[model samples]
Target: MALMTKLKHVDLLADGSLRYRRRIPLVAQEAVGKKVFQQRLQSKEGADLIKEYAEIESLYEQMVAQRLVRARKEALWGNTPRETFKAAKVSSESVWEGVRGLDRDDPEDRHLVAASLKDEGVKKLILNPNKTEPKPTLKDALKLYRKERVKDDAAMETRITRVWSEVEEAIGDLPLDELKRENARKVRDHMISVEKYGGGNRSAATVKRMLNVVKAVVSFGLVEFDLGDKTNPFIGLKVDDQGDREDTKRLPLPDDLTERLRASLRGDLAHIMTILDETGARVGEIVGLEGADLFLDHETPYIHIRPNTTRRLKTDSSNRMVPLTDAAQKSFKAALKEAETGGPIWPQYSRPRGSDSASAALMKNLRKLTKDRKFTIHSLRHRFKDRCRDVGMPKNIQDQLLGHSSVDVGERVYGSPEAKLRLAAQWIEKLT
Candidate 1:
């Protein structure tokens, strides 16, 4: 014979009979002394056992409800002394008279009366039944969501602040429930338009990212605040094609411009640009580097790119050791000499502001050498990749050197880190 499945909150006894087992609510337990509330049901069979369990469960709820009622009543009337009641201008007799007016036969009425007595706001609503509950505004919801969910996440917190700021500017503080698809579309249009919230016209990707944050905020509010039955207005929203712009596909700088930029750049900013040009590391990765991350003494000199308290790598693949070229070694050595006592290699830009600060400093000097807006600090990474491709380096080897995850499963899963380092070192040496 097949064994019967156990029901929730119902346990099987030693004799194979089901028992109704549930812990009483803490409030009820406190009001009425803690005692065994569980009982063995009469039925032993599956269907009959479930039926009996339901009936027992209902009785258990009623028992707890009665205890709660008593506790609330005591809190409201019995606990308050006559002197305290007089101070509040509330008479003991008047409170009892109001209680007596509530229908004793109706459980709902009793619950409402007890709830109103406990809460001043609820009591006011009870007295004036026509008064409506205030719905939380989008700004309120976003603030609560940030506190509960994204407070610890710097990137998420920044994105939420930016997205919500835009939404607030376009449409004033509206109720979260009142935000519909039409409002979302309007926000999207405003973001894409040249009318700056802060930055100039937002690209499609930016608009999409902002909308995604809005959706996440709405979704978080629904679940976090018990508003799941409500609709998420930001969901399934789309940005127009006109908003879409391709990512920067900057070409390698001409030899003269590159040389001029290298000569014009100075100090820590100069070293940062040199490192980017030589290693193809992201600006954030280079700026966030610590002294310990440099392994120049090792047989193969490399920089370990990893997450720190200040910032994180773009992806897991970004957490890798990049072997340094001759030019990169020189830059790294210069950077190490100026390293903080025990902190990051570039301490000047080590805090949360590192990446932006470093980029701005570098760009300011770079603009003097080259008029081309396309020749950004990031273009060095592109140039490195282009050089690797030009030299006939294997795609997997290129991916490893650049901290990009390989699309090929064989290379991703089976390729050894040592093998990758060897190939990458050889290819990077060729670029020098």
Candidate 2:
């Protein structure tokens, strides 16, 4: 089966079929488990046999490359006996002979090869055919950040992802270890100078917040990767004297405006308004609801506020159960009739910016009802808090029901969920 004009390491089997054969290096034999790696060449043609030889040879080369890198790392760690694992014995020919002719037809393969080249540069000449990569950039750390910190409207996701976009623009995706204090300052100045809305520059407050997000992301990475010795460039920078003001916060909706708005709501808007009035859930949280999040068959009906694939809750504390009032019960019953089990109750807004879309629609309706900007859709949440306070609901109970920040209402003291449901239903009835 061997052609006389053919490649090295090609052999004829006893059955007269062609085969490719090679010896596995001693260091990698433990991982691969054989002295020689041989595979039958299915093709009997001359050109095809040579092609199969290269393909088989490349696989062997890849294994050798990985074993050599690991052996080098082990020697450096002083974990392996030096003479038994000599990386210096690795021949020049073994480093990515296959990679040189790697299929450029594959997009991911080409991209990874290029990206690896950018990191190592001219000083480190070899491509890692083993597919090992070194160190994460701020962009890389963003992936880790997303796993740990999910927030409203994907707030952590939005703000943090934006930080990486800015990082990529300014610094070319510098590794986390190389991110110096100067680099953070560069990003801050870049943010300040950019015109986010028309000709108007990004506000000092906006810049400060971006820096805070950057700090949070970097701090998260340092702790997670155990790179505490690395300097965090985003921390304690002097971008300010203009701090947040409490007066700018959304006010409770006036009673007359609430009554007028209640009268105006119709169709899907009516259902959303009724749920907001009864439960004080965020507009986004309501629109992003899946049918499973609602419990109607129980003795007391309630809406569970939590995160989903498309929507992110502001914090873990945002997840709580709100017992429905009579109006909410009617509205949700209608939604359940139309919605699929475990599917979105309001499919229109169950997406990446679904809440923002819902906000625009709500605000457009609110603008027609009132000229005042102070009484926005979010005032419903404030009004709910005020209503609870006026009805003399225990502060802890109010906090627990509304998902406001409170140290404890004592989960043990709250007892079973049925007890909590009965307790919440009693208080929510007063809001009606």
Candidate 3:
């Protein structure tokens, strides 16, 4: 029951008669004491009544302060009904009996849920009503992972291969559910550590890329096989590339150095690098380029790159004709002369059985050729971008040249073969 108190005071009338008044406390329990106190004050025992009333008010104030403290404590720490009484140590078990007695619509259900989580020794199990571990295998997860990649709008097959390779090396045998954060971190650390021994210190960015793939696979598992709510373990893992080995860094090659490298290179590698340099085409694009795609008509020769048709261009603007420079034109002429009927312009760039091993071989050769210029063959593409920037090419044209039109063009119009060829000629002049 609620408690209250009363105040007693006396007043003198104009006719010289004494009268009394009482103030009542707010609660029903205190109202009883207050009523009796007021009765005594009305009987003219004013001083005694006043003293009684003051005591009652003091008691009421104490009860109010204590009740407020209890309510505040209950609101903060009390989540479940059991926890509420447990914290408050309230003897009135009935207070928490009726759901309606407490605010049933209070938005503290999350806390109540957390408080009621099952403690399963070492591993606290929440919502494990079935009392069994979710049996999602890593192999199954990986299968789904690969299938999804195949259907990806962007077919990241190479990236998928790389991710699978690491998973195989580190925790391939483990189940998906068993591949927890600590194990993942250990594998990543091991990869970083042994990198120098295997070849050289691998870039953290490269390691992170591999980890991110694994992380993505885990996320897929969550959706494919409903794992209970847990924070994404890979979200906050730091992968710093700032201090990675100089040779491992993937920055653009200098324009002057690239030209020198092209001139110095002997056979197909040099020709391929030059093509990448002149056209700003990606390694994938260059590998897939063909003599049929190149047309030597209409005042200037142009290449018609189309996805799933002439060649897989990967973008609409990647189909652009980069008007061949003298160097590029001569290089292609020689390449065409050297090739079989169905062979590509730079046939060496084609997947020559086990593309991974071939790619690694190419990087090693590039490393030696650049005389520790310290970058992969892929950096030639980066050099192209840097060269474009250095020559003040518009961002749109630059993006087009790099085959990056994966979305709607913002303000900048997509270029045609003629426009691109013209742009390429200007860009080549800047390089020279």
RMSD of each: 25.8, 22.0, 34.4
TM of each candidate vs. truth: 0.64, 0.57, 0.56
Across 1-432, the per-residue lDDT of candidate 2 in tens digits comes to: 436235567777788787778888786787666789888888777655554554565455545554544543343223112211223224212433446665544666556555654333321323333333356566556556666675433445544555555655666656788888898888888887675421223456778877887788788888787888987878888785342234234588888888788775555666887788778888888988888788887788888888776577876778888888888989988877777788999775565445655565566567778766456787888888899989998876787787777776576345876777688789878877
TM-score of model number 2 = 0.57
Cα lDDT tens digits, model 3, 283-354, are 666556666676655466655455532235445656655666667776677667877655566444343222
Candidate 1 error regions (>4 Å): 1-133, 193-202, 240-249, 368-373
Q: How accurate is candidate 1 locally (lDDT)?
A: 0.68
Local distance difference test scores for all models: 0.68, 0.67, 0.54
Of the two candidates 1 and 2, the one with more favorable TM-score, higher being better, is 1
- Deviation in Å, model 1, residue 137 alpha carbon: 2.2
Alpha carbon RMSD to native, model 3: 34.4
Better of 1 and 3 by TM-score: 1
TM-score of 1: 0.64
What is candidate 1's lDDT per residue for 29-108, written digit by digit as tens? 88867754788878766555544654565456546655655564344222122223333334323443567656644657
Per-residue error for 243 in candidate 1, Å, reads 7.1
12 Cα displacement, candidate 1 (Å): 91
Q: What's the best-to-worst order under TM-score?
A: 1, 2, 3
What's model 2's lDDT at 132?
33
